[model samples]
Target: MDFIFFDADGRYFNFLCLYQILYKPVILTIFSAMQTMRWAFMLCTISQLDVLIYNFENMKELVKAGNCEINEAFKDGFKKNIVHHCAIIQFVNTIGRAFGGQILLFFMINSFIICTTAVQFFSIPNPLNNIMELVWIFGFLFIMIIMLYIDCYFGTIITEKGSQISMTVYCFPWIDLKQDLKKQFIIFFVRNQQDLVINASKLIPVSMTTFRKVMNWTYKGFAVLNQMRK
Candidate 1:
């Protein structure tokens, strides 16, 4: 029930009243923007997971096929799976962001609610009332920065390292734990991966034209995606 600048004007008026009047719409606008961000993250997560599952399934099938039948594209696919697995880590990181942002949003909404009630005690407020505002506004920002950094940088590294384990542990229950299919899958995957390396080894003397074409295709795809993001 603390307040600030309650001196003159018979102390009937409170600064918080003006503050709320001016701040509510702005806070609501930010809340709306956060909702949009949340939705976008959800859709983005779904899209990434869908692509990952699709590509992983396709690559798994290619690996299940014998090496003699594997093609260069399928070899590229094996490489792509590693990248996709890495991407899954990133998508999971996005989940952390989505969750953390919602937490922040809750804090924001709570702050707004506090603002509404804050003036109620203005009549019997202490001289330190203004300090409450500064504490919430500034302290909350500091907490948010730490939250985002920890979730993005620190959590990503941990999750990326754990991703292989997560893939195995989490999916083991769904997969047939029998010996036959397990042996077949490992043998098939390893044989194909090694064969791909062997095939690639033989093609190390790639033609300059093929190398340039690959470089061009990669650059073009990167540019397109970058542009789309922009």
Candidate 2:
């Protein structure tokens, strides 16, 4: 009976080891790939916005150089550019709708992870004895912080670039153009007066401000946990 029990236990241990060695890595790899794709999508959106801004800048240069003739063709091209701007805004809104929930969850989870990791790192009694463990913990903490920063950084860029459009439109020589074109310029300028902002689940604005708040909350939670431990 004792020999049979030992064999069964050994098999169970091997099964768990195999699951950990094989299954966990595969699952983690899939998750990492998904995250990479999501960020890539965000970057693609930003690049599109950059292209729109570049076009606006080119238009401004043409107007400044007195090369833009106020004719039917110019009017048609101007209207098309406004339409393109609206299309880009729609694309941004679509991205927010698709990824807002995921972004919210990411912020929540990373905040908890950061707080707990900090507490654990500080709680360790013998820093020199468990060097590898310490390194692992620090690496994870760094990655979490970096991920948060990247998200917020991109969000900031989007807001800044979007705001730049209004200024670019303002710089156009609208006063010297035809009355109809002046009206169109006014409408476009008024439309762009509001800065573009991406919100998480339509609740949290995903900018540097949010990033700072998350870090502050994490620090507060870490302090509280340390106090409880003491």
Query: Which has the greatest lDDT?
Result: 2
lDDT of 1 at 64: 58
Off by over 4 Å in 1: 1-22, 59-68, 71-74, 94-230
Candidate 2 ranges with C-alpha deviation above 4 Å = 1-18, 70-76
lDDT of all predictions, in order shown? 0.44, 0.81
For model 1, name the residue pairs that clash: none
* Every model's TM-score: 0.34, 0.88
Clashes within 3 Å, all models in order: 0, 0
Q: Global CA lDDT of candidate 2, please?
A: 0.81
Per-residue alpha-carbon lDDT of candidate 1 for residues 116-148, written as tens digits (9 for 90 to 100): 333332323364757776566556545543333
